[model samples]
Target: MPALNAEKAIAQEKAIIINTESLNVRNGPGLSFSVAKQVHKGDEFQVVSSENDWYEIKLNSSKTGWVANWLVTLKAGSSAKKGTVTEDGLRVRDGAGTNYSVVAALNNGEEVSITEEQGNWYKISAGSIAGWVHKDYIAGDAPETEDSETVSNVQPDNWTGISTDNSLNVRNSPGLHGSIIGKLNKGDKVSVTGSVSGWFRIEFGGIEGWVSSQYIEKPSSASKPPANQVSYGKVIINSLNIRENANLNGKVVGSVKQGEVYEILEEKNNWYKLSLKGGKTGWAAGWYMEKTVAEKPQKQQSTRKAEEVQILYNGTNLRSSAFTNSAIVARASSGETFPIKKKTGEWYEVSLKNGQTGFVASWIVSVSGSSDSAPVNKPKSGGLKGKTILIDPGHGGRDSGTIGYRGTFEKDLTLSTSQILYDLLKKAGADVILTRNDDSYSSLNTRVALAHYHDSDAFISIHYDSISDSSVKGYTAYYYHQYQKELSQTVLGSLVKSLSSRNRGLKQGDYFVIRENKQPAVLLELGYLSNPSEEALTRTHSFQDMAARSIYNGLDEYFSE
Candidate 1:
C-alpha cells in the first residue's frame, strides 16, 4: 500500500520549501553547486529534480537549490506530488528516486524549497546546511515531471561509516548464532554484496563474512580496499614511563626504558611483541602504551605516512583484511595504537607497532580525540565543590538498573539527567565528580570507587521514579544511612521547592552506591516514568535544569547549615 497521510494530501497542490535555508553544492547530493538564494518560510519555487526527499528546484525567478521534503504545504493547482515527512528526516536520492543516497534531516516546523517538478517530487533548496527535499512530504500541492535520471550517473564514490559503540559479532557463516569466527569494532569498513535476512556480507582482509548492517555504515561497491602494501606505524604510550622487558612478560629483560625505540615484528592479542636491539624479542601489552592493534607494523618496504589512530574501546577484533569478511588476526582494546597500511574509502588497513597487520573499525576508535585531548590536564578534583556538585551518571552499557514504564530504560534517563545536572552544577561553580564518563557500563562498586578516588564531599545518584502505574507523577530522594540525612534533606528540599511536581519527600533506602561510600550519599528519583507527560518532560533540558538547580541550591543550603 502507498504511504499516505495529511501532509501528502495537502502537498499535491502546494509549492513551498522544506528543511529551509539549505545551501546546495557540488560535493554530495545536498552539497551540490550552490545555485539560488535562501527561500524564506512559505515561499514558492520551481523544482527541477525530484528524487526521494530532495527536490532539485529553482524559484520562479531565482536560481536553484535543494529543500527538505517536510517543510512545505501545497498551493492550490500546484504541480507537485503529495508526501509527508516522518518524525525523523528522510533520505533524498538523485536521478529517478531509485537507489537512495545519504539521508538529509528535516526537523519539525521547517519549510522546503522547490525547484523542478516530477511525478511526486519538487526540486527545491533545503538551504546551505542541508540541501533538498522530495515533494511527497509537501502538504496540499501537486506537479508532474519526467522520470529522467538514472542512479549510475549520480552515485557517490565512497560510502560513509557511522560509529557503533558495541563490539559487533563477525561470523564465519551468515545466520543467527553463526559460528563466532571473530568480532569487529565500530568504524571497521566492509565491502557489501548479497545480504541475508538484514545481515550484510562484507569482504575484509581477503575473507568474507556477515555482520549486522545496522551497527556500521552500509557497504557500497564504489568503495574497495587497495592492493596489499607495506606501511609504517609508531607506538604511543599514555604514560610516558612505560617499562620494557627482555621477554613478553615483565621479567626485567633489561628495561629499554621509556621513549626508547625498538624494531617492529609481530602483534598478538593486546600486546605488541617487538624485536629488540640485540635480535632479542620483548612483548608489551597494547594497554601499557597507546599503540595500533591490527596488522603487522608496516615495514619501510613501502612508503606511507604514519597515521595516528586510537582504539575505539577495549577488545576490538583485528582482521587480516580490510573488510569484516576477512579472517580474524587478533583483538585490541581502547587506547591501543597502530599505523595505517592503506585506506579504502573509510576503512583503513592498519599495522600494529609490533608488525601484526589487520583491519579495525575506524569510527569506534577516534583518530583525533585522545584521552589527553583536553588541554591542561586539570588535577582530578577533590570532593564535589561546595558550590557546584558533580553527579556521576551510572549503569551505562550493559548495566541497566531497573526497567520502567513502556520500557523506559533506566540507564538512558540516568545518564541523560546526570549530564544535565553536571552542566548545571559546573555552570553554577560547584566542583563535580562523574563516576563514569561514557556509556560503557560501570560496576556499582565503581560508583563509590570514583567518589573515594576523588574524595568527593558529597555523592548523589540521579534516577527516575517507577511504579506499576503508567500514569503516576512526583519525585523522591533516598539515603542509606543516618550520616547522610543532612545531605539528603538539602537536596530533597531544594528539589521539592524548585520543581512543579508532587513531593515524595526524603526516605530511608539502602542503595549499594550510598551504603558503600565514605562520603555523604543521596539517591534521587526526580519524577515518575510511568506518567507520559512527566516522562516526556523529564527527557527535556528544561526539566533537567530545574532538577539540577534545585539540587545545587539544596547543596548550598546544606553546606551552609
Candidate 2:
C-alpha cells in the first residue's frame, strides 16, 4: 500500500522550466551545496520534491538537482495571474522555493503576467525574466487568457485620452481578469477607439489594448478653436492680461503685448474670446482689444497721385483704420517706404506694394519734405517738481523673471513702466535717475548703491509678481522699514484707484533693495503675471500711465505732508 502511495505521488509531479536566461542547478536544497549544472531559460525538468524555498527536480534519468523555487514555473498552465513586484531586488529562483538557486532579480513595481499557481508560489513573466514569486509579495488578481476569436468586433472612434494613473496595465481584453499586454504611465496620451464595460480600447505605442475608463480623461473641448474661422484682433495694451473666464475676478492664464495680433473667436460681456497660437484660448477685456480688418489685395498704381512716406519705427503696425485701436493689416519695418493716399489726424493712409491699403501711426512715419508732427506730451504737475527720485526696474538680460502665458516678460514690463514713470516725473520737474535705462543686468546691491550715490529723496523699485497658482491677481506695495510704510500705502492706494485692479494692500517685506538702501525705499508689485487678467492690464500703456501718475501723485502727497 505504501509503494502504491508513492507511485501516485510521483504521477502527480509536474514538469517545469528554467524561466530565467540561466539558472544554476545545485546538488542540495541550500546555497552551501555545489552546483550540478546550469540550465538556460525554457529548459524543462520534472519536479521531484520541495523543501523550504528550494525544489528538488529530475534533470534526466540518472540525476536530480535543487533549484530556487522562484526561477521555475509549471509547464502545463495556459493562464495565470497578473501581478506586480512589491519590493525592489526580489530574487527569482530556479524552483518554487527560496532554497533553490537564484536565477534573476525583479525591480520594485515591476509588472508580471502570471502563468500558473502552486502551493504558496505564483509563476510569472516580467519582460525578459520569467520566474516564480512568493504569493506574499505580489498584488494582483487571477489572470484570464484571451482567445483571439472571441475579441469584440467594435470599431474604434476618433476620441483621444490620457492615463491618470502612475502605473496602469493594458490588457488584451476589456476586464481586470484579461492578460496584461503593456503598461502606461501617468499623463500618457492614447487614441481611444472603443469602450466596453468600464474599459477603454486604446492604441498606445502602436499596441491596441484595454485600460480602465476610470483612469482616462478626454481632452478639453475649449482648448482649440473650431476649424476655418479667421477673425482677428489687436492687443491695445503694452501687456494685456488673458483670463480663463470673461470676468474681472477670473483667473489669469497669460498676457499679450501691445502690437500683437490674435484670432478672435467670440465676444461676451466685456471680454473678447481669443484663439491664441499653440492650441490655447483665453478671454481678454474687449475694451483693450480692437478688431483687425482683413488685408486687401494690393491695388495697381494709377493716376491718383500719391505722396511718399517712410516708416520711422523698427516694427510699426499698418492698420486699416485712422484710429490707434484699429485692426492691424501688416507690419512696416523701419526704412520701408510706401505711397500715401492721405492723412487723417494722427494716422497716415498708405498703399502697400502688395496692393493692400492700411493706416500707419503718423508719429511712426515721415512724409517726404513734411514737418514732423508735434508729439502729444503730458503736462507737468507741480507737487513732485525738484524732488530727487531714483527709479529701479527689476530684472534684466538673462534673468527674464516671470513669463506670462502670452510670453510677456516681467523684466520687459518693468522697464517699460519705469521709463514711462521717469518721463512723467521728469516732466513734472523732479530730478530723476534710473537704475537701468535698457535691457541690461544690475545686481541688487548695485541698485541700492546707485540710489545712495544719487542721494535721492525716494527710491522706488518697479516689479511684477508671479505665483504658481495662476488664479492670484492684484497689485501690492512693499516696504522694508516703518518709515516707508506710509509711502507704500499712498502709492498702492493711488495705483488701485488709477488701474481699477484689485488692491493687494501694503506689507513690510525684506527685499535687498528696500532693506539695504539708506534712503526711503519702496518696492511695488504692479500686478500678477500669473493672473491672466492682471497681466494683460499691467502690460497696457494706459495702465502704465496710470501707475506712473499714481506714483507721482503719491510722491506729491508725501512731499506735501
Candidate 3:
C-alpha cells in the first residue's frame, strides 16, 4: 500500500483547550498514536487539519500534532491574553529576555497568572513560582494588571463535602508541605468552612484542617447560581422529599407539601436548596419543582409583544449555553412558559423567573404566536417511528473487554446484541445507528461525536458486567443525571421483567459514555459474566433476543409518555 498523507485532510482554524485537566498531544489523530506533548486547560492552538473527531494542532512554529476536538473549543477571533504552556519543560525565567536566570521549569499545559509585560517577555506566576516567559508560548488573553479582576474572599454557607479517597490527609495549610493534622476515610462527611487556591478547609470530627479540593465532593463554582439571584420554587410532587445535601444519598431532612412555594437559595447538580416555612432549609430535586412566576404589581396592558415559549416535555433541561454539553442551569416541566430573549440554531435563549438567562432545546418547546412552534397536541405516531437512536457496543478490535467464565468475549457478545437491536429498531421504522458495525476500534470521543452528528434522540451503550465475585448476578441500568434517570429506570424495569434475572435497579454511574453524552443516554449492564450460570445463559441467542425486545418495549413506553 502507498504511504497515507495525513496533512491533506486538515482544516485551518483556531481553537482553545477547554478540558480542565491536561490533554495529551499525539503524533497521529487516534489513540494508537504516540504522545508528542501535552496541552493544559485554557491553552490555544491553530488547527492545521482534522480527521474524524481529532484536530491536528500547530503547537508552535516548529511543532505540530493532533488532539481530540472535544477537549478544545473552536472559535473565530483574536485569542485570549491569558494562556497555558503547550510544551513540557518550558523555562520560566526571572526576567522576560533569554538572558534572565531560570526561576522554574513549567510543565506542558500549566496555568499561569500573567501580571506585567515588557516587549516579548510577560511576567507570570505558575503556582508559587513567579517568573516571565517568552510571548510565543502563551495561548489565552493577556490582560494588563489594572484590567484584571480582583479575587473575592467570600465564603459559602451550609456546604458539606464527602471525601473521595481513603485516608485523605487533612493539613494545617493549603500547600503540599502543610502539616498533616488528621485523616479522613472515603465517604466521610466534612463541614467545609472555606477555600484557598485549590484547597478546601474542612471541619471533620472536630478537627479543622485543609484538604485538596480535587479529592472532595463539593459543589463547584459553576454549579452555584449567581449571587443575589433569588427565585421561588413551587413544589409539584406530592410530599416532595428534601435532603440535607445535594446528592440522592444525602440524609432526608423533611418533606414539602405539594403546591407550597418556597424561596430558592441555590442550585447544584439539578437539586435546589429551599428555605422552608419554619426557618429550616433543605435540598429538593429540581425535577419535582417548577419555577413559579412571582406576582407582579398590576399595570395597564402594554403594546410590547410577549416573546414567550412553553415547554412541551417534562424534565427538560435549561442549559447555560446553546450546546447540550453545557452545564444545566435549571430544569423545567411541561406547560411552563418562559420569555424568549433570542435564538441560537436549535436552542432558544430564554429569561427565567429567577432573572437568569438559559437556553432550551427548540424541539421540546412551542413558541407562542410563532409559525415555528410545534403543535400543542403531539402526533399519534409510535414514539420510535421517526426517532434516531444510537446503539453503542462497548468494546471491540484490540480490546476484548471482559472475558466470561465460558470463554465468551465481551466485545463479540456486545456487537452481536447491538446488531440484533439495530435490526429490530430498523424494522420498527426508527432511524437507528450503531457506533460500530463490526469488531472495529472506536474511541469514547468518537462514539459521542457520532451521537451528536446524527442528532440522536437517545443513546444506549451496551456492555456485560464482570467482577471477582462470581456470586453476583443481576441486570443494572445506569444514568449520570436526574434528567436521564427516567430512561434508565424504564429500560431496566422492562429488561428485568422480560428476562430471568435479578433486578439491580437504577444506579447513578459516572461512566464516560453516559456522563458525557448530550442526549438521553444509558449504559446497560445485562448480566454478570463472572457468574457461571449467567455467563452460560448470556452466550445463548435466546437471551440476546429477549433483551433486545425488552429494550424496544422500554423505548416505546418511554417515548409514548
Candidate 4:
C-alpha cells in the first residue's frame, strides 16, 4: 500500500496565463532574485513546477524562469487519462486519503477513467461509480478518447516477439485510442497474453497491455543472432531517419549517417530497429542498412596482454599474414569487436572468436581503449592537436537551465556532457579549457574573458534545450558573429551525422557569451529537455560520447579546410 506525499510527487501537467501588462520572470521564487526573462500579458506558458507564491514557466525551449503566481492565472486542471486496475480489492474512497469513506472496491483487470490526480491518488470513474484510489493500483499512461467501437479480439499462433521501435507504447486496450500503460524499447522481448485485431496484448510493466503487431517480430533460428551473441547493422546510405513507427507515415525520431554502425535490435518489413547509444532505439529502412552477422567475442578468461579492437567497415578480409597478398583467412563484419595479440607493420594480429589468429588492416579497424591502454592511432598533429579549445557548460550553481519533464536539472546534464567533451579533446592533444569544471557559477562576462585571455582557437558552449511545447525536439546551433557561422555549421553538421535526434540546423542568436567573444565560437542546444523522450536520450553516456566525438570531428574538418 502506498501513501500520499505531496513534496515528492512529480508536477502535474498545467499552464499559467500571464495577467499583468508585463511580468518579469525571476531566477528564483522571490522578488529579490534577478529577472531571467519577460513575458507580456495574454502570453501563456507551461508551468514546470510551483513554489511559495511563485510558478516556474518555460521561457524558451532551452531555459526556464520563475514568475509570481499572483501575476498569472492558473489554467484548468490536467486532462483525463485512462487506467486499468493492476491489483484486486483496491479501495476507492470519497477523498484522497485513508480517512475518507470507502466508495467502492476495484478488481484486477477492471478499466477506469482517471479524471484528476492529487499527490499519490487518482480520482477515477468506472461506469456509475466515481471516487479516489491509490495510484499504485492503477496503471495509467497516455490520454485517450472515449472508446466506442468494439475491438475485434482474436487468437494468434505466436506468443513471443521483439519490439521494433525505440519506445513502443503499450496501450491498455488494443487500438490507438487505448490508454498507454507502458513502453517497449527497441529489441524488448514481450510475452503475449491476448490478441485483438492488429494488436497483441502483452505483460508490460507487470500489467496487461497492448502493442501494435506491425512492430513485433517473432524470433527464429535463421533471423535471430546466435546465443550470447548480438547483431550489427551498417548504414549504407548518406542519411537514414529513425522513425517512431516502421511505416513512412511515422514521425522522424532520430537519424543515422552513412558508414555508422549500430547493433540490430529487431527487424520488420524492410526495416531494422537499431540500438544507437545508451537506451535509445529506432527503426531505419533495412534496405539502406547492410545487416552484418557479427558479435563481440565471448568473454575470455585466459591472461593475454591484448586490447580489444573492432572492424570499422564490413566484409574486411582477415589475411594469413601482415601483407595483402597473404591467403585470406576470413572476412570480418562491421561492428564486430576482437582482441589484438600484437601489432605488425600496418596490420594487427588479432585473435578471432573461433580460436584462430589472423592479421587485419590497421586502418580498417579501430582500437577499443584509450591511447595508453590500447595501440590507438594517434592524430596527425595538424588538426585539433595543441589547439586551444574552450568549453563552456551553460548554467551552474543556483542558475540551473531548463527543467526536464522528469524533474532532471539542466545544470547537471551540461556539466557531465562537458566533462566528456573535455576528455575527448584533451585526449586528442587539444589544450581544452572549461568555463566551470564543477557546480560553481561563473558570470557570462567571465566565461567570455577566458576565450580572449587564452587566445582560444574555438569556444563551444553546451546546453540542453526546453520549451512549453513538448513536441518540439532536436538539436539547434546558435551563432552571433559572421565568422562563427562556418564554425556553427561545421560542428552541427558533424553532430547531426552522429546523433539519432533530429537536425534542427543552425540559426543566428544574440547571447552574451558568444556575442562578446572575438574568437570563433558556437553554442550548441543539444536536445529538448522539455520533451520527455529526448530528455532521457540526452542523459545517456553513449549520447554524450557521440556528441563529443562529432564535435571533435567537426573541429578537425574545419581546421583541415
Q: Write the per-residue lDDT of candidate 1 for residues 1-561, one digit (tens) a residue.
A: 112122322223335443333322221122112334555654665445544344555555545455544344334354323333422454555532333364456653344555454434444445563334544344323222111222223322323343253346655544432444445543333445445444556543345555655676754547643322111112322222222542244554544332233433543332345655556766654333322122222122223244556563468788877676888888887456677666665466788766777787654443432232211212323433553344766456544444444334566667757766777667656777776554555555456555654556678888776654555689988887777777898889898778998998888774556755556779888887667678767766578778877887777676665
Candidate that scores best on lDDT: 4
- lDDT of candidate 1 vs native? 0.53
- lDDT against the true structure, per candidate, is 0.53, 0.69, 0.70, 0.72
Model 2 lDDT per residue over 195-305, tens place: 765777886434568887889889796764323223455564568889998765779999987535575666553356887868899988755654432221111112234
Per-residue C-alpha lDDT of model 4 across residues 1-561, encoded as one tens digit per residue: 112124532346787778667877878664435578778999988888776446778888999888766456666365567888876688999976565899899887798988755545677999988998877678765323223324443565446787776447677777655555555655566777667557777765335678888898887846745553555565645588998776667789988875456767776544568886668988876646544343342222124345776664569899899998999999988667788898887688999888999998764655655253212322333788888899999877555566576545677678878888898889888899999876666756568656755667889999888766778899989888887788899999999889988999898875656766667899999998778789878867689778888988898987767
TM-score of each: 0.35, 0.34, 0.36, 0.36
The best candidate by TM-score is 3
Considering TM-score, which of the candidate structures 2 and 4 is the better prediction for this target? 4
lDDT at position 353, candidate 1: 64
